[model samples]
Target: MVVGGSLGGLAAAHELRAAGADVAVHERSAPRTPAHGAGIVVRPDIEALLHRLGVPVEAVAVELYESRRLDVDGRAVREEAPQWMTAWDVLHRVLREPLADVCHRLDGALRRVRVEGHEVTAEFSDGYTAHGNFLVGADGIGSATRRLLDPSFRPAYAGYVGWRGLEPESRLPGDLRELLSGRLTHFTSDGMQMLCSLVPGPGGELEKGARRVNWVWYVNVAERDLPALLPGRSARRSASFLPPGDVPPETAERVVREAEASLPPALAELVRLSDPFAQPVLDVPPWRMVADHAALIGDAAGTVRPHTSVAASKAFGDAAGLATALLGWTPAQPLPAVALEHWEVLRLDRLVTLAGTGRELAAASGLGVGAGRTFFTGD
Candidate 1:
């Protein structure tokens, strides 16, 4: 059974079914249409996973060139690396086709796990229970499975928040338009950093009123300030919960005004035009990726900072690896701790290195000088 029916869970279920196993996915959210972020950068590992899952890589738009531009006070530096930017919804749509046969139980929030000698059962908040040979937690960062298994593990705030939004390419001012029209661009100075990129839309190319430019700007703030910045209402209910719209009107106005005062002109203009949204940055220390018959994948397993642009790839890797291990499972040896341990051993080193690299690069970007390409290049 796969707990959490997002990309990781869906991928895991698809892989298991291909290997001739019956799979079921339990998700907490309502059965609404799939929605995701503006775009995602696909790496080699993610590409390989998609290929292995019988997904035609060519069906999805792939950005093949390596274009990296970093600017500080208008002076720029450039480098090359293998990268592809594709809309998140496009990737999800491609993956969803193969998972049609899999049983997806929506509105089934995992409340607790019951692990007996050789079998595991999951109890959901909606009074449903599922029995399976094993349980895989792809439940994201605030995973109930993780809490039940290891309550000691908690996500630590990363000392900053990422404010992100998307705007049409045509709406940008002339100077801002020229700076961010093509190529992935970044501007960094004095504890502030901004990234803007032209990413393909659902329609593929920008013909007239079609394409969008995505933006993510990072700024450091005290942890105490987050409550005031977050939307005053509960985050669990709203599907697209964001700080500006959810907070009191007066507070929201003040936050926008403050952002305009502190951010650069191009970034400030984007914010002025954008319906602002905020995501609190957080990182998890490495954990034993497996415990008993259950294993954590994706954000639930652990998350590194986004500076490395490896979170999605790492989650894809986890799903692929776990599927491979489960293929050899037999009735006599229902769950093999050793096999899971091997997977954990392989991932731990990479996670540690990535966390350190992200922290260092974030610190450097905060200091005004642009960071070196080591983090992005994986060197």
Candidate 2:
């Protein structure tokens, strides 16, 4: 059984089912449509996992030929390898179709989990219960499974917030669109940074007027100051806890105004037009990745900072690794402890390093130009 029907849960369920296990996914959200972030960058490992899950790579937009340019104060500094960008909805739409045959119970929020002997019982908020040989919590950072197992674990704020949004390519002026089209561009200043890239829409074409631009801007803000930046009831919530549509009009305007004043012209315009969403960056310690019958994957396991763009790939990698371990499990047997340990070891170093690099970038955001080279080795 996999709790939480988001990307990690879905990927876990698909892998387990492919491994011939009787897998059932329990999602707390309604069954209508999947809720996801603005955009996701798919690295090679994620692409490989999709291939294994029978998802065609061609169906998703691939921005392989273009490069990611890093700039500071409007001056080009560095360039990194190409990356693919796709709307989360588009990717999920493709992933959902293949998993239609799998057993999924939506609106089934788990309230408690009881592990007795070799069997595990999951109690849901709706008063229903299900028993399975092994339970997986792909539930995300606030995982019920993790709470039941280890209440001491919590996400640690990484000292930064990422503001993101999407806009139509045509919405951008011609000169700005030309520079941003078919490429991932970054414009940075001291504590402020913005990244813009184009992704194919429903038509799967990049014709001058055909695609949409996805943008993410990272800024360092104090945790105490976030409340004043939110809208309505969310104003009382912490930066790490704010949900979608929580930014107040005044706060939103402040964010856009700051971008306009500090960022480069092309990048500033993207933020100006963006309906911004903010996420207080955080990372879970390595030890938090382990539990009784389940393991954390993606942001649920821990976030490696967006600087490296490795979160999605790590989640898909976890799914792939976990699937390999459960390939021959029987109903009477337990999941292999050795396999879980192996996965943890494989992921720990990369995550820790990325988190450290993210902190470094956050601390010295004003350094500009040469700063991008310190964390990212490419270009």
Candidate 3:
């Protein structure tokens, strides 16, 4: 069983089913329309999962032909390979296509989990109990599974926050469209890093005029300002992020003002006209990932800072790794714990490296590994 119905949990459910395992996803959150959760840089791990599920993903993403860092003269420092950009909403849909035969129950929040003999049992908030040979914690950064497994682990928050915005491609001034729409652009100043690229519009509208420009500005925020800054739009402090529309008009304006003062003209204008939100940059340590017969996947395993841009891909990697191990193990040699162990061994190394790199980039305030090279050598 997978807890949390977002990208991680759903991908875990999909991968396990593909490996011929009977899977069920239990979500605590109420079922609702998937909002454009956040913009993501599409990587091969995500593409491979989509291909395996036969989910058509071409229409769900905006193709970016280049990536470059800007110099003081406003010229590109260097250009790199093309990449695809899309929203979490689109990828979530892609992962969910194959779950029709799998049990995906919403509002089934897990209240307690324990291992009895060789079986793992999960008690849900709705008072439902389920037993399985193995359980996976694909929850999220605020993962209940992680806490239950190792209460000693806590996510570390950086001294900075990522301010985000999404604007219609057509809404951008015509002169800036060509520079920003088909490419991922970056600017660094005063130790702050800002990036902008295009992504498919809501519902995956790929037309030229229908696409959206996505930007993330990493800025330093003092501890004293956090309470006011975070609650500007959302009334409560997020363990991770405050989604759009919760940001107050005045606070969004201040963010725009900062962007104008700090970012390049094109990105600054994008922030000025777009609806905005913010999420704290968090650092988390490497998890054991596996405890007894249960495994932690996605953000549950480790919260890689956003600088890696693999938050979703990392979850897919974990799910895919676990699924592969389960698929290759023969019944005669079947040891659920051994398979989980192997997967955990491989995932821990990866997650630790990612967390370190994320910290480095966040430490640099967003300029490190901005080109997707340091984070990924191959899928």
Candidate 2: segments with Cα more than 4 A from true spot: 32-36, 68-80, 202-208, 232-245, 364-379
Query: What RMSD value applies to candidate 3?
Result: 5.6
lDDT of 1 by residue, 1-379 (tens): 8998877777777777766678899989888634544457777766886788765555465443445455433555666644567666667667777778778889878988888877888899999989987888988777778888887877777766677776666777767766665467777666667776766666555443455677777777565556555655454322123543444555446546755666555566777776656666777777777887888888787777777777777888788788787776864675766777788888777777787887887887772123322111111
Query: Among all windows of ten consecutive residues in candidate 3, which has the lowest summed lDDT?
Result: 370-379
CA shift of 109, model 2, Å: 3.0
Highest lDDT against the true fold, candidate: 3
- Candidate order by lDDT, highest to lowest? 3, 1, 2
Give the better candidate number (2 or 3) by TM-score.
3
TM-score of each: 0.85, 0.86, 0.89
**Per-residue lDDT value at 203 in model 1:** 56
Better of 1 and 3 by lDDT: 3
Clashes of each: 1, 2, 3
